[model samples]
Target: MNDWISHFTSLTAAPDNEKALFNKARPVQWGSDQIIFHAGTPCNQYLLVLEGQIRVQQISAGGREIVLYRIGPGESCILTTACLFSHRPYPAMGITETAVKAISLPKSVFDQLIGQSGLFREFVFNAYGNRLTDLLTLVEEVVFTRLDIRLARKLLDLGKHAQIIQITHQTLATELGSAREVISRALKEFALRGWIRRGSGQIEIIQRQGLQQLANSEFVSSR
Candidate 1:
């Protein structure tokens, strides 16, 4: 109960309702890389992540993949909630990025809380709005911005923890919604300029400032 309360502000405000939610929720676990839900699958349960990350991505008919968003500890999925309310199958896929511990709420209990608790209602709407805005931003970037800039920014993000990023070209392509050849060409240009060192399934950032400049400007003409 303490863990649930701490993770959700809605639960924290309504201590009395916490017990009801706890009674209804079933704890679930998923291993790394496991599929939590697939595209076209019916949405039956609402998930509250207690720990680890769940990546929500979309795959096209041509087999190209693009990451939409991620759900982490203390967060819920807006897409899941929307599907439940609209009674539609999921249009995107959700997979566990790491081993996860979460709580799955039945539809009945979810509706009950939405109707009975103001705090919970606010939490749900706010989460939905925020996630919706993020998805919209992704769409704008994909449509209007240069792929090279997006890829550079993504590399800088992954390189924050360490200089070396252990990811393949194809994975990076998927992350930025580009093809493998496009990613390879971008990486080749970066390497030629001594901005990074690339190896099998890995890239080492050599010039942080250079990558930062590229991410910040439209200076690098899109190839």
Candidate 2:
């Protein structure tokens, strides 16, 4: 009884419908870093996350990975929804970022709900559209934005609350679609500027305002 209905803002399930859905869904748990889906594999079921985070990412043939987005509590993966509708293999990989609890709905039940419930349909489509927009934004940043600015923004985002981030350079590189050498070089520049201090798998934001300026420096000449 995960109360799946509350996750969708557009849908309010009737008592009977709610019970049916709850009974039909299979509860699943994934530990941190577990692969939920692999690229080129067909998705067997749609997932509704009840707890924790799932990271969706794409890997290039050269082994470079770029994170597309994350699905958290009360969220579902739009890519899996597309796979279910199109009857195709997943185009990217999904992994658990933390220990996750979810409910898996078989294709038949999911399709039935989509066909019978207008609110569910709306919710699904809206979620798909929002994720599509995020992918597009990521593409724009990767193609048009400078790496330094993107890295700065990413650091500010991660260290926003605690002013310290516990992550490896390679991990940060993966998130920004850059190489480890590039991230290391950029971090060195930030260090020289007295904005941040880097340690083993950690970064401390010493001058938050200065880092913010670097992160927001859109007009800086890109080399």
Candidate 3:
């Protein structure tokens, strides 16, 4: 119950009563690269990530997996709202990037909590609002930012990890909505510039500051 309360607090303000109602929620584990849920599957529960990262990807009309976003600990999956309000199936596929621990609440329990608890309702609203903003930001980035700049920014964002960034060219292509050859070319360009060094299974950032500068630079006459 205490753990459940903590998880709820991280997501939104849950009153003591609402938290108590969720005390019986069970925790589920997901192995690395496991599929938590699939697109178009019937969404019966709300998933709250307690640990690890999950990738939300959508298949485009061209049959390519487009990375929607990554959700880490303390984030709720998209099915939270869809299961409650929509008749159409789950919208996106959720794949675990690492071993994951999450709590799944039955749709009926979630609806009961929402109906009986104002705090719970507010939490859901805030969570969805934040997710909406994130989606919009990603949309804007895709529409306005150049592919090279986006790749640089993504590399910089992943640089915070001490371990080598373990992503293949194909995976990078899917995440960036580009072709594998394009990602390979971009990596090659970065390597020639001495900003990054690629290895068999990972990419190491040799000049993180330069990468940051490239990520933050404006459209200008000089690089």
Candidate 4:
């Protein structure tokens, strides 16, 4: 129990105070490609990732599964936060990329813990703030960054963990808020530069540092 409390406490600031409230935590298992929960489903519980990857995605009006973000181990689902305060259905779907282990707590318990513990509240507050900052950064990228530059940055970011970094053109398009053809062309440009090697269902990052340099050139130039 001390180790478990210490793990979460390291993620934030206060551990001893929030430890008791998590005594009733329940474990949930999700298989690969399984939907942990669907968009618009009633939110009664929240989950904290213990293993594997979970993606938060929403379908656009045009029927694209736009990825909001990827949550790895040590991150909690945003749907959990939404459920704690509101009765509405979750706004996005959580899909497991690999077999996943998570801890689920009733919405009421989650709220009570946060409300009674300053350290727990601070952690959730910081998590929410980080999410907002990420969203704003994505919005700014869409509004002001060139499509090619954005694509390059995304490639660099995703390549950090992926061994083969496989993603379809349609998926890339959805993630970038652009058409498939546009994403394809940008990828082709990267291929031409020897920065990546394109495949039918994937693009292998060949020159990660070069791609990163290209992504950061604007900042470098400003400096």
- Report the number of the highest-TM-score candidate: 1
Clashing pairs in 3: none
C-alpha-based local distance difference test score of model 1? 0.88
**Where is model 4 poorest over a 10-residue stretch in terms of lDDT?**
1-10
- In the range 1-223, model 3's lDDT, one tens digit per residue, is 4475576664346667777778757788989999877867887777778889999888777767778878887778655475667756767788898999988778788878879988767767787888888888888777777777888898887778753798788888888877888889999999999999998767888998778888896653222
Q: Looking at candidate 3, what is the lDDT of residue 11?
A: 36
What's the true lDDT of residue 51 in model 4? Answer: 83
Count clashes in each candidate, considering only residues at least 3 apart in sequence or on different chains. Answer: 0, 0, 0, 0
Question: Can you write out model 1's per-residue Cα lDDT over 1-223, one digit (the tens) per residue?
Answer: 4456578766676766546675788889999999989988999888999999999999999999999999999899998999988999999999999999998889888888788877878888999999999999999888877887888899999999999999999999888888899999999999998999999999999999999998998553343
Q: Which runs of model 4 end up more than 4 angstroms from their true locations?
A: 1-3, 10-20, 160-165, 192-196, 204-214, 217-223
- Please report the TM-score between candidate 1 and the true structure: 0.93
Best by lDDT: 1
> Number of clashing pairs, model 1?
0
Query: Tens digit of lDDT per residue, candidate 2, span 1-223?
Result: 6366566544555447644764687889999999999899888798988899999988889888888899998788989999999999999999999999888989988888788766667777888899899989998888878888888899889987887899999999889887888899999999999999999999999988887886777654354
| TM-score versus the correct structure, for each prediction | 0.93, 0.91, 0.84, 0.80
Total backbone clashes of model 3? 0
Worst 10 residues of 3 by lDDT: 214-223
All candidates in order of TM-score, best leading: 1, 2, 3, 4
lDDT of 3 at 142: 72
Instruction: Quantify all predictions' global Cα lDDT against the true fold.
Output: 0.88, 0.85, 0.78, 0.77
Q: Every model's Cα RMSD, please?
A: 2.1, 2.1, 3.4, 4.2
